[model samples]
Target chain A: MMIPTPSALAYVPFVSVANMMRLVHSLGPEHFLSELAAYIEEDFRRWPDFDKTPRIASHSRDGVIELMPTADAESYGFKYVNGHPKNTRTGHQTVTAFGVLSSVATGYPLLLSEMTLLTALRTAATSALVGRYLAPEGARVMALIGNGAQCEFQALAFRALCGIGTLRLYDIDPGATAKAARNLRAQGFDVTECRDAIQAVEGAQIITTCTADKQYATILTDNMVGAGVHINAIGGDCPGKTELHRDILLRADIFVEYPEQTRIEGEIQQLDPDHPVTELWQVMRGTVEGRRNARQITLFDSVGFATEDFSALRYVADQVRGTDFHEPLDLMADPDDPRDLFGMLMRARDA
Target chain B: MMIPTPSALAYVPFVSVANMMRLVHSLGPEHFLSELAAYIEEDFRRWPDFDKTPRIASHSRDGVIELMPTADAESYGFKYVNGHPKNTRTGHQTVTAFGVLSSVATGYPLLLSEMTLLTALRTAATSALVGRYLAPEGARVMALIGNGAQCEFQALAFRALCGIGTLRLYDIDPGATAKAARNLRAQGFDVTECRDAIQAVEGAQIITTCTADKQYATILTDNMVGAGVHINAIGGDCPGKTELHRDILLRADIFVEYPEQTRIEGEIQQLDPDHPVTELWQVMRGTVEGRRNARQITLFDSVGFATEDFSALRYVADQVRGTDFHEPLDLMADPDDPRDLFGMLMRARDA
Candidate 1:
């Protein structure tokens, strides 16, 4: 019997989020979310194969801009993102992002996509993935503080991935809470709009603080966070942007994406530099126990890492293949004679 | 009397080299070269106003890639470039680059252009600018070593800026020499193809070395160099990639764009860490001397820096405005509601 060899044509075509969304809608959001969750989990399992670094950030007066770059042996990926807390006052999203994926062997960019939408989706996916292991079993109610642009995505991801069915939302800006409630209602979610953080946390199994203040304002106090609650803190992402009170952090068993990055940018930045925190990967790898007791409070202090973007880029690329949503960009030159760079220009001029 | 306000449209549109060449060809190359040289000189005089740093580079097995970023309070610029010495053997360009200029206040990308061609132009322009200050008055001939992709541009810029009337050229690859000779002859230059490096430098007032090897290969030795020669060392741009011998550096008064960078990536890499060198800005500022005596050999260790790209970007953006050569690029989203990034996506989806 003759065996057939795998052809070079086995490569998946790249998919932009616009294209991926259409495919996702066609596949139904529930199925797509499940597949994305699986992809994230699988990637976390092979985390050691990646070349990782705490992102290179350039800070400005108003906010901070950062480039998070990572690569494995086969592919390279990076995201350009910014955070300006005061931006929302001017009716602008506090966070905006874009990313590029390239082939490591050739160093040629294969896909360039507007990552603003994908970032929201991936952050939610990662939180949900962590929640699967760290959250209390059959957790159904989440207290969501700071119901801004990312609130609906977080609620939907939890509802779909962790069987969370109801949301208790609170925001300083009542308009933002209303907007989040409207968006979640459109997505078939049941939300209770609360007047205060304490009321929002009442009978909640998960407390998610996604506020956008640049300063260390406590959106969550220790008295508000109850036992067996998974605190998904997302807003306190920079050096001075803490949302949860110090007492709450001291009380909860914390897990982070990357310890070095979390120590600087995550909620743990409020704690001592030498404070013990478990890496989320260790929990996923079964090296550390997560939510070991029924009443133990668990915290996923996710400030977002490059590895999550890498996984998102990989999934988006795989999903976009054979779709009409992307254009082949002339980002790299594949000249017949590479040394004759001038010759290529001369030809372009002549043509 | 009522004073009329100036039109509030002072934005500069960016043009890539391909488009700039079209605009230049229409305006004439002589005018473009002279104007660009003037702009470079003017920017050099105000160098203290700019923020400068040595590029952040990522090294790989085949070659190295780098991100050179710089900014003033008004504008920010960065270039992504890669140098793979073995790339040409596999039908790829040894150097490939692209750059972007953005508004510092808004953090919006204003221009995106291919820099593979512009790099050659800017590098040549920089060399000629340095030669104008360091070379002996009315120098007429330049010995062009390593007649490759960049040789013609150097020759043209020198001819245009420094009153260089003749060229003496030599390269290990005879075909490259022939190509350079043919191209220069078309441009009405007096070209002499010499047998070796020594013969090429025998009667020249300036010697320009631009060979592309990724090792410490001495293309120009101290014995081959003579007194009063202004050497434009252009090719040795990474660690372990020096062209001129150590003794040559010892004999010459080395000037560099950024000393911190040149110490590691330029020909000065061969010298001691404590070796004395002058920054070119200081020379332009008259704080340091360029050439004290006619017999003093001066070297412009031109590894290339980010500030040069900033100058070039500003120059190109200014020249392309009010012309048909550039198309307005929508690289950044200026939503009426900046906080509603998701709203922008919804708009795009609806469109």
Candidate 2:
């Protein structure tokens, strides 16, 4: 039996790590982050129409593997990601990811992309987008307490979306701080390598803590967080991993991507189950006000929701069209007749 | 500052559709199914050691997309699959899948493979493995109902595992039955293309029903099922999709992969929520008997489980070692300094 060749539907567009870097460079990271933030902002504006769920996590002693899945009525997306702090000692990344976007009608993948860098871009874009709404008007100096893999991206995103031109960087490891300072300075920012967290937050309108320890870390204590400053907490993402002291959370008016998820994995996990929090989508939709007063102390408790990843994947799928940035992978089994998969395999022996 | 080439750790082995077909041809289908069944049976024997959850599904108007995730202490695995029956009308497979297996300690993906063929192989192997315990002794004739893409694989597996040399096929669409008959006959089975379900099960000792309709379907009723016959119900996998009539399920001493999942998606979904069903693992462990008497009807309500996909990926990982059946994918970002991701991206401009 001679089976016909597989069709175009068998191919899926795959963006590799190398291709992702090239694409990011082709568009410029600043422009890429800005466009990605636009996509995220657009998705958040229609948040009520989405299918949302807390990420499914498989926790191990050394790390955690999580599947974050979400969909609109038309398209579905899911990301496979892992977080392991000890990986850095072994010359591996603390976090890595890949994601898939598919057609909801036919259930076929349209794009698969390396999401390690994309995750960083989305998190930064999300943080900077939140900064635009909650930070004091015309605020330019921002304190970044965790100068790790995510620091420079956040710096660029803040510069692009929120017009922040000055950055203060700090890390428990001096090497991490020095690296971030060097990268930010080269990117045309007034960068300072701070001595500590207190110095990092000094004279800054925004205090962003992104430390990556898998523990309840006091990266920022109550006294260190000044009044009227917008706090972006990015590192306390998983369970038992909180960045700020509980007192700071009690003082600030918090906004979250998804309340149900932010409560478990975000810094809000430190608070009571029924603690009041605002949804950023509502604020974006203009149904609720942001930064009610200059000294309101707005906090964006960013846990990195699945919809952000969904929006990121959607942005990449759109950008990679008619570009050499993606390789088409023969991932699906397409038979001449849909019921002749076995015959197709048999014929492939000779093809 | 040119970035160094990515480390070997950044590459993951990817088994594509063409390469999977080549691999299956190299090891012959029968041998592949037998080995896959063995791996599944081995994993089933140690059922208590692994984590389990019902597959998480995203249902849309047209079809459904699902993520099935599970892990043991050493490895984690998940499969992304979609079911869209209407896809076949447009020259697309009704079901397609891909899966990943990762290291639990590092949360790094070890293998990414096309599971469309593997899922077919695994599902057929699982049914035949169950058939070994449930099918009547020394039975050589089997009735096959709803002859679709899964029909031939089930026939081959039953012949390999249960010594069933005769095949009786019937389908609502005659073209499907003709295709299955031609394929099975070429594989050296004594084949009969029956006019209807009644004629198909006339003299067979085992009845395998696999239809891909997305609604409640009665391929067989209580009157159609004879005494001492083994019933392998395969198509009633999702909610609202079933094959055997409720009366047949009521009479059969049912065996299930996971009771929680089987109650929701398997043929048992039509029965009481708390209906007693035997765990297949217990039967494999010799803790529970499969078939007690010669005249009792035994039913294997297989909805397919995450552990089965986990075992299939594990088997492929072991088999593909030192082989050319897979390609390396640059899917992860591995920088020299784990915290210097931005530096790596900057250096990539000159690489």
Candidate 3:
């Protein structure tokens, strides 16, 4: 009598961040941004197919750490991110992130990439994607408040995607503004270093706030807001974190990514839960008015969502498929007999 | 004017699973298990420090994937795990898992370890830990029902931790029982192969049912159980999946890991939502009696929790330290200028 043997399984593929960066850089920023935007738009159009939930967050006295996970039938994606306002004091990025993209069918991870760089790229890309509908046509100047790690990416993305030629930058830390100004100048943008947030927003067609403070400080007051200005509020992403004043939200036509989540995490937290806000996808699909009038104040309460990471992962996976930039890791075990997980370990031990 | 420079940050450490195994093997399994038990006990003693949430699960037609996340003020941890009963048909393990341990202050992943192997070890260790308090003293014979991938680890842990000398194994597939018998025989356990579940549970003081079907199939009915039988119900871990009939739960004095989670995911899902169940910790801490009499049926509804992974990760971290098994990956960028996240890319590009 012969004993039954376990069958063999195939190995899953994994792409590390270093390799992913090489893949994205080799593909060129323009192509990557364009492809990522297209992917984001596509996924947004099929929003109902996703399993969406408000991100799970762990909060402490000093910072907040969050896990954003979303899945469709075919793929699963998640990002691990943190927000520490005092991290810069210890010479660290205030926010650092990494993400994984996996095959939902097999529950095997396909890509593990450093989202620090990708997050900056995706946030800028998402802002620009929303700006296409919300920002007035021929918009040239963008007031960039909180000139920190994210400012240069925002400037460059708008330059490439929104045709912005100039930036008005301000920060409480003069050094941060100086860094943004220098980086923008090197990237060939006409940069103005403003002394105050009011000076920065003055006469700018679009205003973006990406500050790192964990307070409800009003960076943009109602009086500083001008007509026809597109407000991309990026920094106010957690509870008690807000850049735009409550009056600004009340006056502007507010837009959000996920209404259920935005109600708790975005600038919309300052507004009533019953306050009507249009989703960005509705505006992108022409189901809702984006900028009703040339002079209307349009707000994009840009709290990052898992869907954006899903799109970014998909785009990265597609761009890196045939490229030599990915190095596969032996992350999963494929044994000749699947039931013999113990056998595989014994073999490894012996070998 | 000087060109403002980007800030650089400090590096974070990452220990992968392959490295962790090599480290653990070098440390020896006995020492590792002892240390793991100590870590788990220590963490359980200070359970209030953790910010715990019930795992978020996404169930599919075939299987279920879950994200278990938890954190304290100092460290953060999460595990991505999947349970697919049909995976064995395609020559895959019924369960696979991986986890990350990160710093709360820096938000960088410190360790990325495979929990497939670790899960087996930790589950066995946990079962044995509970057995020490709940099982009858001098319990020598254990009936291991559904002898699949987890059988060997359970046998070994009981032998090491709970002084169990013999295992009576049974599976619907005789091949699985044969495999478990062979594995345990080599591991120096007195193993008896049984034709049916009733025969397997006949003389054993502890009965462990870890079947892998995703349905409400009862492996143990009320009539089959006897007094002083400590039951570890391991596999009926999702909604609509259970090992014991409703009568079995009613007859047994039930204990669980986390009441809120176990009420939904464990075998207690078959019971009423407000069914009287004592937490295992209460027993461990002497706050409640484990077994009132020799003939009482004590059921442990073992739905895995994040706190267990947190304990396992902490144990692995301690064991792997000062060993030559870990290969450090440059996972987090520690640029000299914190604001110069862009500078890290430029440096990498230049290098």
- The most accurate candidate by lDDT is 2
Classify candidate 2 by CAPRI docking class.
high
- Worst 10 contiguous positions by lDDT, candidate 3 chain B: B1-10
Instruction: Mark the 10 consecutive residues where model 3 chain A has the least summed lDDT.
Output: A1-10
Q: Score the docking of each candidate (DockQ).
A: 0.25, 0.86, 0.50
lDDT string for model 3 (A159-267, tens) is 7788998899999999989987877887788999999999998879999999999998899889999788999999999999999889989889999999999999999
* Model 1 chain B weakest 10-residue run by lDDT: B1-10
lDDT, candidate 1, B11-119, per-residue tens? 2243544565576567555566667777777777788877777787767777776778777778778877778777766555677666777655445456656566668
lDDT of each: 0.76, 0.93, 0.80
Residue A212 CA displacement from its true place in model 3, Å: 0.5
Q: What would the per-residue lDDT of candidate 2 be over residues A239-339, giving only the tens digit for each residue?
A: 99999999999999999999999999999999999999999999999999989988789899998999999999999999999999999898999888888
Candidate 2 at B28: error in angstroms?
A: 1.2
Worst window of 10 by summed lDDT in candidate 2 chain A: A1-10
Give the chain B TM-score achieved by candidate 1. Answer: 0.93
Clashing pairs in 2: none
Count backbone clashes in candidate 3.
11
